[model samples]
Target: MMRIWPVFRRELVGYFATPLAYVFIVIFLFAMGASTFYLGNFYEGRTANLERFFLFHPWLYLFLMPALAMRLWAEEKKTGTIEILMTLPIPAWASVMGKFLAAWAFSGIALALTFPMWITVNILGEPDNGVILASYIGSFFMAGGYLAIGSCLSAATNNQVIAFVVSIVVCFLFTVSGLPLVLQVAQAVLPTPVVSAIASFSFLTRFEAIAEGVIDLRDVIYFASLILLWLGINVALLERARAG
Candidate 1:
């Protein structure tokens, strides 16, 4: 835990040391606002729920989170600093957890900056603040899920673009897994129970539960386990890369 902090601090500071982090934050803020008002029809809805605002999060993170995570290990490998990082006294798991937490914190910052949307909903009328809070929590976990997937892909290659593209594709599959059309296709080839289980793995399904203020233990566990699983894979892959 103590060791993780140094890596976390280093990586977090590294983000702002360049224009990449600033550019990402600016675009992310703009996109969230544009999506809330334009695509979300915030004014037309006339509702104070902020449901329209949170609705686009999974899709938004599909691209944005990958861009944030693509450089996690890709930049390290590209510059051949990965060896230096690995040879440090810290455990690989600590480094892995630290890097992931750094990216996740950065994502949380972007999400938190959208507080204006929340404030607008409050100003408009009465709203379920509980549901809004729950949605924010769910959105953070969803972003973690996206980042974990991107981290694994980034570790697999030294190309940030490849990491971004592949993360989008994989995240898209998880996003659509619970859709009616996708479920229908799965049902045709799989048993009823199998189809149900597969749909349970969908990020949208888990996120929607919390978005509605459910906060089920199962939903939280799914995302927590996902982050752990993929990040474990990330550490193992990095070790293999180091050995080679």
Candidate 2:
């Protein structure tokens, strides 16, 4: 943990040093507002809650998170700085954790910027602030899951575009695994228990539970486990690159 701070600080600070950070935040905010107001019919419903706001997060992350994560290790490798990073005394796992945490923190900052939406809902009517808070937590965790997958893929290739596209494809699978259409197909060929297991693995399933103010321990565990699993893969990939 101690060794992780320098890398964490470096990467976190590096984000603000470039225009990429500002552009990403602007795009993310605009996309969320547009989706909520237009596609989600936020004003038409005249609802007090942010159901429409949080509903689009998984879809938004499909594109946004990968774009943010595509630079994690891809740019390093592209510029030959990865060799320098690997030669440092820090263990590969520390470096991986550090980088992942930085990306996650940046995402948390972007998510926090959506507070005006929360405030708007409150001004419109008496919204259930508890559920809104839980949804924010769920969204943050879901972003971490997306970033973890993207981080691992970014480590696998030097091309940022490849990293972004592949991450979206993989994340899309996890996002839709619980949908009725997917389950119907699985149910036809797979047993009930097997199909149920597939549903449990879906990001939408876990996140929806938490978003609804359920905050189930299982949902939290699922996100944590998924993030850790992908980060472990990320570390292994970095270690392999260092060894070679």
Candidate 3:
């Protein structure tokens, strides 16, 4: 736990040491503002619901989360730091957990910065705070799931660009699985149950429930399990790489 704290502190500080964190926050604010205010027609339509903001998240995270996670292990491997890192007395799982938590917390900060939108909604109309809070919780867990996948992919390669591209592709597949385009394609050939099962695995399917203010236990479990599954895979990959 002590070793984990040092790595977490280092990675958290590392995020602020570069322009990456600033750039990400700025772009994220712009994207959220544009989506909710201009494109979402929140002002003109005067909708109290946060559908517009939540709608844009999967696509936004599909790109931005990968950028945040691309350097996790890829940069270490590329600079020969992984060799030295492995020599430390830290358990592999602790290192993976520490780094993953740091990145997840960083992403959570970016998500929290969008709170102004929630404030705006409350000021404009009688927004349901309960639902809004649930939605925020859902978004945070979803981002963690995406980050776990990105961390795993980053660990598998030394090139940041390759890691970024691969993470984006994998995340994209998860995001689009339940969309009409993908479901339509699946329905054309697969049986009804199979198609339904495929769509059920989508990120959208799980998130949409929370976006609607229904904090179902099953949905929470699904996202938590998704995060843990990928993190376990990440640990295994890093361990294998170190051994090899």
Q: Among these predicted structures, which one has the highest lDDT?
A: 2
lDDT of 3 by residue, 156-229 (tens): 99999999999999999988899999999999999999999888779998899888999999988988898889
Give the per-residue lDDT digits (tens) of candidate 1, residues 151-229.
8899999999999999999999988899889999999999999999889989988888899988999899999999999
Poorly placed runs, candidate 3 (over 4 Å): none
Better of 1 and 2 by lDDT: 2
Quote the positional error of residue 81 for candidate 3 in Å. Answer: 1.3
Q: Enumerate residue pairs that collide in model 3.
A: none
Across 146-194, the per-residue lDDT of candidate 2 in tens digits comes to 9999999999999999999999999999999999999999999999999
Model 2 Cα displacement at 12 (Å)? 1.2
Summing lDDT over every window of 10 consecutive residues in candidate 2, give the lowest-scoring window: 235-244
Judged by TM-score, which candidate is best?
A: 2
Cα error of candidate 2 at position 201, Å: 0.9
**Backbone clash count, each prediction separately:** 0, 0, 0
